[model samples]
Target chain A: MFTAFRDHIEKNFPQLLSKPGIVACSGGVDSVVLAHLCTQTGMQISLAHCNFRLRGSDSEEDELFVKKLAEQLDIPQFITHFDTNEYAAAHKLSIQMAARELRYQWFAELMDKEELSWVLTAHHLDDSLETFLINLSRGTGIEGLSGIPPDSNGIIRPLLAFSRAEILQYAREQGIKWREDSSNEETKYLRNKIRHELVPVLKELHPTFLENFRKTQVFLSESAQILSDYTAQLKENLFVPYHQGYKISISSLQELDPLRGYLYELFKEYGFHSWNVMEALLTAMSGKEIHSKTHRLI
Target chain B: MFTAFRDHIEKNFPQLLSKPGIVACSGGVDSVVLAHLCTQTGMQISLAHCNFRLRGSDSEEDELFVKKLAEQLDIPQFITHFDTNEYAAAHKLSIQMAARELRYQWFAELMDKEELSWVLTAHHLDDSLETFLINLSRGTGIEGLSGIPPDSNGIIRPLLAFSRAEILQYAREQGIKWREDSSNEETKYLRNKIRHELVPVLKELHPTFLENFRKTQVFLSESAQILSDYTAQLKENLFVPYHQGYKISISSLQELDPLRGYLYELFKEYGFHSWNVMEALLTAMSGKEIHSKTHRLI
Candidate 1:
């Protein structure tokens, strides 16, 4: 496990070994193991903890455990508190979304103050699987099924290559003590239901579901990159800038098979979701227009 | 329902209206509704039934239902029987796989004999969803998630756009009587478990799950098509025919962003599934070769 972790960092994230980063510790086994692996691999990282205060004393204990670990390792520790429910109410967001916003916001501030290169999170293969299932059920394009990327923006997740079982095994072998989040056991949430029920059944159906899922994600991500490149090239060929707006060649667009799909790919970022309206634009009046929330096509 | 069915045919399968075709009827609500729609649309389609005999008397009843439906529609009917269990054992395939193989093989022969333009099947959106889930669980690439194609070889699935609920409603509205295959309700099989257990939960997760799923499939299929085109272009550039084999340029292959992924896309058809050895081949000694079941890379 150590060798694989070391090799992974060396291959994918060698910069972490020289530059300092912030590790977001949830006091769960996933994050704790991540921090441990970072240290073992000679990567410079500090522990950062968020006390959302949703789990009362369990939240406090989680913060305390993370602080003690930082002290034991003699590294920097950053802690933040949030009244998550109040924030959720104020923002009209779910508790999970509120916590996520608060956590990332704080991580940004910490990174700015501490001069950290990246913020490392402990999202594992199982988390990606849960996310894949959630997005699939909710209905998503290739981007949604591509799994959680190892590197996104200023955040990096090195543990994504490993499964939850592997993380648990590593923690056990290394005698790592971590606080368990009680909420994870509650199957009321959709993600929990997927993790607890759907994932186990998927695993039972295949001996290497997680491993195969990881491979599938690689294909999806690469395919997504290729498509994005193709779409960009197509956009370059079709869209000609004219007086602060680009005139798209309808004839060129019509040449593509499944024109609606191509239109969706090219203009989806502009917030247009109505395939009917976008498709109809091809045959509509010369001056007829379509408006998305962010952009307009005339 | 009739108008939508007619519009669907006119837009996508207009050739079916002008030419004669064979409808593979399973004596279920889906196929019965499809056969009715074809007749109503003035499409010349004859019903073809395959009694796999796996369900004993139920198979006989299904065949009888299909035969009556054909008689009522005033179209020619073709029927075939196979001892599916014995075939499965001999072929070392599951009963479902064996039945599928027999059905398609018989359909091909029938098409050849009857001078049919296409073999139509009643594989609706739900069946595609089931197949997608199965492929996803078993680990597959983008092609797996793209869902079942509306047209494959001479077999065409016109009902891919409609949901099972819509098909059922159509059948009821048209007073189209069909047999209920008792085996569909048995959760012992993986496909049944997915259909009965997984699909309902998925639908409950979102109000327009199936509708959105259809849209997602469109995006996936387009993405798959784009990637396939890109792969073909890459293959043309990198592979030069030399004597009896293609001389693949290693430098061009290595220039790909994710070499292993590109390698998999390019050589996967050659039956090479060992990605590790394939990647290692890049840096291995010159003239060292890797052999797949059907092809060799030197």
Candidate 2:
């Protein structure tokens, strides 16, 4: 597994090891494995852990576990305690969303301050599948259905290549001791519920659900790209940039084959998410005073 | 209304008036109004109606109604009767889908034989809005949610600028008599349900829900265009086209800011939809085979 990990890094992200970076270590099995891989590769790595203080002693213990591991590896460790509950309340965000924003924002800040090249996380394939389902259930377009990215901004997921099972297997083989958060088993989080229940049921219905879904993602991504390319060409023909958004020539738009996907692509630029809105805009192209708080297309 | 219709055509599709066209007159108020509008403008027009024969005698009545109206207007009329049930069974299509395909296919044939430039329909703003909601409910992506286009292929919707209520008002003002399809009132069909129930309920929730939805479509269309444009530029930078799909240079992609919407847009070109799949892909870039039946991106 380690050899596979080494080969993967060398092949896919050869420049990654040359940069100083921070691993978002939670002392969980996945992160521990990731940290171990980084250490084994002799990469310049710093461990960063967020102590959300959600589970009192358990949260602190997790922080301590990561700190101790970093000490044993003789790598510097950075830990931050967050008042997540208060943050969630103040921001009116779900705990998960708030925590995510807080953690990533803090990680980004640390990266900037320390001049770290990237931030690595341990998000894996199963997590990607779960997110795909969640977004699907919530009524997403092709982009939303695509799932999590490999690298966003300066954040990289080195362990994203592995499944939870694979990570656990590797951890066991390496005799790597890690902490498990009981919250993972709690169904209160939509992701956990999806991981524990929905996915298994879906897998039973179609044994290759995950594989097929991942495949579909790849296909849709490609299809989207083709459509995107077409839209780019259309934009050159149809649009002129405006102050807030864009000014589309209604006559030019009318001239284009309606089935050409460019019209829908045009709608997404203004933060509209539904087909009805597009219809309204098409209708309004004639004459109507359609207004929204933030934007108005007509 | 007739003047507005003519003005729209003259402005948007001046070439359309130079050629003969067929109006898909359904004998419903909207289509009746459209037919009258065309005749009033003294444009070369042929009236066409499809009798799906689903409503037995009522279906025949509609055909007769359209024939008499066309005769009254002293215009060429084309009428066809379809055994929709048989067609549905043979083609493995739902009755509604079968009827749509049959009607369009017949229209295309009529256009070709008659040397018609386009097939005109009476799809209005209300219909467009209903389509938008239906797609939204189905969790459609940006493209699907963009609603009905004013012109598709050789089909043009001239009355899309008007609402159903406006169409009825215009018909009444013009003293136009038309047959009503009872199926439209039936809640069994998803479109009817949306038209009668869902839209009203949504309107109640937000007085401008319909308007806002329409605006959202416009916004999303534009946003989708921008993202797609960026994706196209990024694709050229990171991928080389292959026969099957495209080969992505992992290093070039990794060098890009992943949070830039273009990353997801680039992945979407390949067919990934869920955020998780993108995350998984990012992880896979670190060296795991993200496999599907037809393709694998490692």
Candidate 3:
């Protein structure tokens, strides 16, 4: 595990090892394992902890555990508390969404303030699989099924190639202690249900389910990148700038096979999603229009 | 259901209506519903049934049911029987695989003999979802996750756009009678287990689960097509014909982002799946060769 971690960092994230970064630690096994690995690999990293106060004393204990670990490892530590429930109510967001938004926002701010080049998270392959399932359950495009990326913006997920089982095994082997988040056991959340129920069944069906999923995700992400590149070229040829907006040649668009799919991808960023209406606009009488919340096509 | 089926046919399979085709019937509700829809849509069609003889009298009953349905619909009928167990033992295949092989091979022969332009199947949205889960559980790339193709070769799945629920409702509404495949309820098969257990949970997660799956599949298939097109262009530039085989430019291949993925896709048809070894070949000694079962890359 240690060798793999070092090789992974060296191969894919050499910049991470050369510069200072922060590990977003929850004091959970995954983050704890990540922190251990990062330090062992000689990466300059600090611990960052969030106390949403949802679990009361458990939250404080988690914060304390992180602080103690930072002290033991002789690393800098940062901690913050959020009025999560109040924020969720005020922003009309679910508690999970509120926490995520607050967490990432703080991570970005901390990275800038602390002169950190990377903000590493402990999202492993299982988390990616869970997110993949979540997106798949609700129906999503290739990007949604592509799983959590290893690197996006300045944020990095170095543990993404490892599975949850591998992380747990690593923690146990190293005699590492971590706080168990009680909420994780609650199946009321769809993710928890999938993690606890769905994933086990899938794992049982194949010994290399997670590994296969990881490879599949790589293929999908690459395919998505290829499509993005192709669309960028297509946009260059099709979207000629007009007075205020771009004039697209409908005939050229029609010439593309799976026109509706290409149309969706090309116009999706413009807020157009009613695919049927968008498709209809192609063959509708001239001057026919379709409007999204932010954009219109005529 | 009827309107959706009609629209799907008119939009995707209009050619089937203009020419004669055969519907692969198992005396199941899905196929029965498809047969009714194709006939109602004014498609000249016949019923083709394969009795693998695995279900004793039930298999005979299914064949009889399909025969009676063809008579009722006033269409030509073709029936064939296979010693599925014997075939499985002889071919060293699972019973299910043996049955599938026999069924498709017979369908192809029947199509050739009867001069049918198309061979239609009753594969629906749920079946696609089940197949997706099955492939995912076993680990697969985009093509596996793209769900079943609606049209492959001369085979047309006109019912692919509809769900199993929709098919059942249509059959009930039309007062159509069909034989029950007791084997479908057995959880021993991976597909059946996923269909019975995982699908219900996924459906519970979203009201439009099947619709979302269908839409996602469209995006994936389109993305796969785009990648395939891009790779075809890459091959044209990089794979120079030399004597007996093509000599690929290693540096040109290396120039691809996600180089291993591109390598995998480009050489997968040549049977190279050890991506790491293939990547190594790029920098290996000039004459070093990587051998697949059939092909060798030097």
Kindly report, for each predicted structure in the order presented, the TM-score of its chain A compared with the true chain A.
Answer: 0.92, 0.86, 0.92
Task: Say which docking band candidate 2 falls in.
Answer: incorrect
The residue-level lDDT of candidate 2 at A279 comes to 64
How do the candidates rank by TM-score, highest first? Answer: 3, 1, 2
lDDT of 1 by residue, B1-298 (tens): 8898899999988899899999999998888999999999999999999988878789888988888889899999999999999999999999889989999999999889989999999999999999898888888888999999999897899999999889998878777798887887773477877877777877766778898899889888977877777678778988898999888766676777666667777887778864844654665666677777788776
Candidate 3 chain B: worst-modelled 10 consecutive residues by lDDT: B274-283
Against the true structure, whose lDDT is highest?
3
Candidates 1 onward: DockQ, in order = 0.53, 0.04, 0.63
| Angstrom error at residue A126, model 2 | 0.6
Where does candidate 3 stray beyond 4 Å? A53-58, A83-92, A182-188, A240-247, A269-271, A274-298, B55-57, B83-95, B173-175, B182-188, B241-247, B274-280, B283-285, B288-298
lDDT of 3 by residue, A249-291 (tens): 7677778766667776787788887484465565467666777
- Top candidate, metric TM-score: 3
lDDT of 1 by residue, A1-298 (tens): 8899999989998888889999999899899999888888888889999999998788888999999999987888999899999999999998889999999999998999889999999999999998897888777889999989989987999888999999999999999998888888762488877766677777766677788899889888987877787778777878888898888777677776676667777887788864744655754666767777878777
Error of 3 at B200 (Å): 1.9
Candidate 1 residue runs with Cα over 4 Å from true position = A1-3, A52-61, A81-95, A172-175, A182-188, A240-247, A274-280, A283-285, A288-294, B1-3, B53-61, B82-98, B169-175, B182-188, B241-245, B270-295
Residue B73 lDDT in model 1? Answer: 94
Report backbone clashes per prediction: 0, 68, 0
Question: Which residue runs does candidate 2 get wrong by more than 4 Å?
Answer: A187-189, A204-212, A229-233, A242-245, A254-264, A267-270, A274-298, B1-298
Which candidate's DockQ is highest?
Answer: 3
User: B112, model 1: CA deviation in Å?
Assistant: 3.3
Docking class of 3: medium
Model 3, B224-260: lDDT tens digits are 7767776787788889999999977666776776666
* Pairwise lDDT winner, candidates 2 and 3: 3
